[model samples]
Target: MSSATGPEEPDFPAATAARLDGLGLLDTAVTTCRACPRLVAWREEAARVRRRAYRDWDYWARPVPGFGPPDAPLALVGLAPAAHGANRTGRMFTGDPAGDVLYAALHAVGLASRPTSVHRGDGLELHGVRITAPVHCAPPENRPTPAERDTCRPWLARELTLLQPALRAVVVLGGFGWQALLPVLRDAGWELPRPQPVFGHGAEVTLRHTEPGRELHLLGCYHPSRRNTFTGRLTPAMLRAVLARGAGLAGVPCRWRPGTPDT
Candidate 1:
């Protein structure tokens, strides 16, 4: 399969992602990937040299995987693991301020079993929702390059492919995640809106799958990152509203109601 110069790019990640059949298998593949040299080195280094507050902690130091049921009807798209967050706790959106805000909102709306996501095996549960990211590793300054996003996209594409049967609503956090996920959705047989919908908080769009009459609703929300939440730009109320809307669209039960306290 190789000429003297080899192919333009080795698509091992994409090829392997396509062969995965289940979320468990996908997790295995994602956590083991070293497809991006820069990411591999960065994630490992962060884990090796942890922050002072977590010096006593052992870091996962590898590519993190999506969390929640394979049959979830709603999915939350994030950017990637925070160095001291998922990288430290081995769970997406865990062990960080971002996780704190997100889990609290999910709990307020009855989408999560607990208000906190401390670590894996903490008895926390998600109802009808799975949370994933475009990239899995911790990038420097919490920003991954374009090349890294593209290299890691196969995992997200495969996840969408596997979840499409049960998935009804997607809640994307931040513009970067929105940008990353549209192509994956398109690849999973959904026709995106012409001109491509731009990302914004409170933005909503519907995508139609190739099968006639099949539809998936998408809602955009600000990333529950510290920058957004700390600045009060993305309040708990704002988060709960978008989450509740997504849950309602996905047919997931919730206790929250519009115009009531956000909880």
Candidate 2:
């Protein structure tokens, strides 16, 4: 099922893209990602080395991608997968400490099912939130090359377009994802704030498009990586605050209660 080709010209018709109000576009995008072969091969190799970590677990053979309600008003954009996390579990923000921090925050903010993320078969799901990484593949040392990031940018663009109806705000998880988003916004002719918005927990801005001033909210936060979480650089409360702020910008009231679906 592995194909060594780049993303095809998206057959996403305007009408089809328009109809994706509540589709599972994240799952589809993950299953269809064909960005870079180097990352793909590295992910596969990581899987082999980490087989003991997932001995009784199911691993996604291809690049692990994002998953959640496609038409959700809030979209969580994370950095690339960790070699042992999404790369092994085949689900964004799963199978790692970072996933734990993120899932816990989403759960607290009325987006996810629970505070803990497990294997692919764990049955947990996002109700009104979608999770995606700037780079699809887990880069070495968790850092993606510039070319790889550029190649992956179009995928995020198509995702945003397809999720128009419910896409209210984009929560960027790290500096890399935030920087990657700039080019996309520029391509869409959206105006950026002066000096650029700095990355911090709960820092957000609304971007205006020229034609009729249509807008999308942009928010920033530190990455929910193991390094960040374990070092206390990011906490569950901090992450929750970021989501709550983004929810406010989107005009989506977060009924942040355990197990309460946001949809």
Candidate 3:
């Protein structure tokens, strides 16, 4: 994950270690994360500051891990852990207002089976979508430094490989995610001369990767962060439209009959 989308040395080994189940890999990664000391400190501080809200809540005191159905084909790349969101819940896109809207949209589109994402314990699942972040640790002000992104990418690379053999399209949430994903595409020898056009809401750019010569459809969207939604920077329909386009690009059929609600 290069900061400014510059080509970097490929860190993904020709092959990764034996792939483990999704949950098992997530668990191990969380335990071994030491890429950024600042993020770890910030996450701990956020938890302590909001300790009252989580007095009875079991705070997962480690880098939040991504979670989804084990065999999902689509990977959702979010920016980073929000201070009170994944940083507190120890799961990507969980325990936050943003997740409420995201999970609902997923359910509407028939990708997620659950309507609410209360916490990691809630039995929410995705049919084809798996979520991960550019950085595992929660950074100060929710903004990760370039050093942090570069340092932590090994985890992301590993997660991608583990989820692979099934990975198809990846949806990057914002510019940061798009930047992080660029090196990944480059490593696979899929670098475009002109950087892929970046715009919020489902902009589909074809990614060229060799070895298997798969065309990975890259979709972009505004992150479901409180700063964007609470201030009305992004509308619910706008977000849904992006997801809908992504579903179409991924060849997921729409089942919203005239008389039926999206759910």
**Model 3 Cα lDDT, one tens digit per residue, 116-192:** 77777777767777888868777887789998887767567667767666776788888899889777667655655
Report the Cα lDDT for candidate 3: 0.70
lDDT score of residue 26 within candidate 2: 43
Candidate 3's TM-score reads 0.83
Q: State the lDDT of candidate 2 residue by residue for 105-199, as single tens digits.
A: 87778777777887677888887677887677888888788988876766676677666767779999988888988877777677887888777
TM for every model, in the order presented, reads 0.94, 0.83, 0.83
Pairs of colliding residues, candidate 3 = none
Please tell me which predicted candidate would have the highest TM-score against the true structure: 1
lDDT of 2 at 250: 72
TM-score of 2: 0.83
Candidate 3 local lDDT, residue 255 = 45
lDDT of 2 at 195: 86
Candidates ranked by lDDT: 1, 2, 3
- In candidate 2, list every pair of residues with a backbone clash: none
Query: In model 3, which regions exceed 4 Å deviation?
Result: 1-23, 253-263
Q: Which is the better candidate, 1 or 3, if ranked by TM-score?
A: 1
